[model samples]
Target: MTERVTLITGASAGIGTELARVFASNGHRVALAARRADRLATLADEITAGGGAAPIVIACDLEQPDAGDKIAAALAAEGVEVEFVVNNAGFGLFGHAIKLDRDEQLGMLAVNIRALTDLSLRFSDHLIRHRGGILNVGSIASFLPGPGMAVYYASKAYVLSFSEALRGELAPHGVRVTALCPGPVPSEFQARAGFLPGVDSLVLNVSPADVALAGYRGLMANKRAVLPGVGIKIVPFLLRFFPRGFVLSVVGRYQLRKR
Candidate 1:
């Protein structure tokens, strides 16, 4: 029999690392994928030492067009089939759309949008056969229009919509899909985005470990979307009361302040 495994991308650090640990502790054999081979190796060792099955570490940049195919091939080579997929590999840049480097923004889309969609749909047969699940990491930005970080916010919006639609399509097949939307997570993400957290971030921030646990629980419960904190859970609800223009203005000012 082929071994069933959970495939988690962006497993090198932050919420992705925590998600891997949580899944492994719950008895899921994991496949860790990230650009950082050393980080992945360390995480693999930690999981094994903690009595979890050793993880298969695939170190490849998701920016490549064939990243999904590579991940599939790696798993096939090991005789493992995916029972769960965590599309947690993504990044953002904090700047006005016109001001940011064009190539960098497009690269973000390659990983955040294209690669995520590829992996989510690539193993549909395996997911159906195993009655599996998918957990996609979106952001609070998914619900709002961002003026400064336009492309990044839009990419997460795609994640939310795509995950929901995919969930409906797969529900009858006993496959659960959940979008994990967090707000202001303190991680390498802020650094890479060139963002310095301000008052808003402090108000909304949740620890990466807590976010991962919440995402795990939410996915198991078959929730359509998991917002990890009380602050985050209120965001969409509050968005309902505000006009789109007003919300856009607010986000625009916030991003401008960060810049």
Candidate 2:
């Protein structure tokens, strides 16, 4: 019989790395994917040492158009079928949309949007056969208008919406889909986005390990969405109390201050 494994992207660090550890600890053989081969190898070694199944490491940059195909091929070569998918690979830029490098923003979309959608859909047959699940990493930014990080926020919005719709469609097939929306966690994301966390981040931040455990539990319970921190859980509800224009202005000003 072919082995079954959980495929986690962005598994080299931050929330992604924590998710890998959480899933492995829970008895799922994992396949780790990221751009950093060295980091993935180190994580794989750690997982094996902890008594989890040795993880399959696929070093890949999700910005490539064929990234999904490449990942699928790698798994097929290993003779393992994907039983769960974690679309945790994503990044953002902090700037006015017009001021950011056009190509860079598009590359972000390629990874955050394109690769995510591709992987989520590509293994539908395997997921159905295994009665498995999907966990997508989104941000509380998914719920609001982000004037400063426009494209990144928009990409996360797509992730949330797509995950919800996919959950409904796959429910009858015994496949779970959950969007894990966290407020902010200290990670390389801030550095890459050129963002410096301020007071708001301090108030909303949740640790990556906590976020990962919440995500694993949420997915197992078949919840539609999981907001890790109490602060993050309240964001969507609070958004309902504000006018869109006012919210936009507030976010714009806050992001500007971070610059």
Query: Per-prediction TM-score, please?
Result: 0.99, 0.99
* Model 1 global lDDT (CA atoms, 0 to 1): 0.95
Q: Candidate 1's residue-wise lDDT over 102-198, tens digit each?
A: 9999999999999999999999999999999999999999999999889999999999999999999999999999999999998999999987899
Off by over 4 Å in 1: none
Question: Every model's Cα RMSD, please?
Answer: 0.6, 0.6
Q: After superposition, how far is residue 209 of candidate 1 from its true place, in Å?
A: 0.3
lDDT of 1 at 116: 97
Q: Candidate 1: give its CA RMSD in angstroms.
A: 0.6
Candidate 1: count of backbone clashes, pairs at least 3 residues apart or interchain = 0
Which window of ten consecutive residues has the lowest lDDT sum in model 1?
Answer: 250-259
Q: Compute the lDDT of residue 114 as modeled in candidate 1.
A: 96
Go through the candidates in order and give each one's C-alpha lDDT.
0.95, 0.95
Tens-digit lDDT track of model 2 for 1-259: 7799999999999999999999999999999999999999999999999999999999999999989988999999999999999999999999999999999999999999999999999999999999999999989989988999999999999999999999999999999999999988999999999988899788998999999999999999999999998877888998899999999999999999998
Cα deviation at 90, candidate 1, in Å, is 0.2
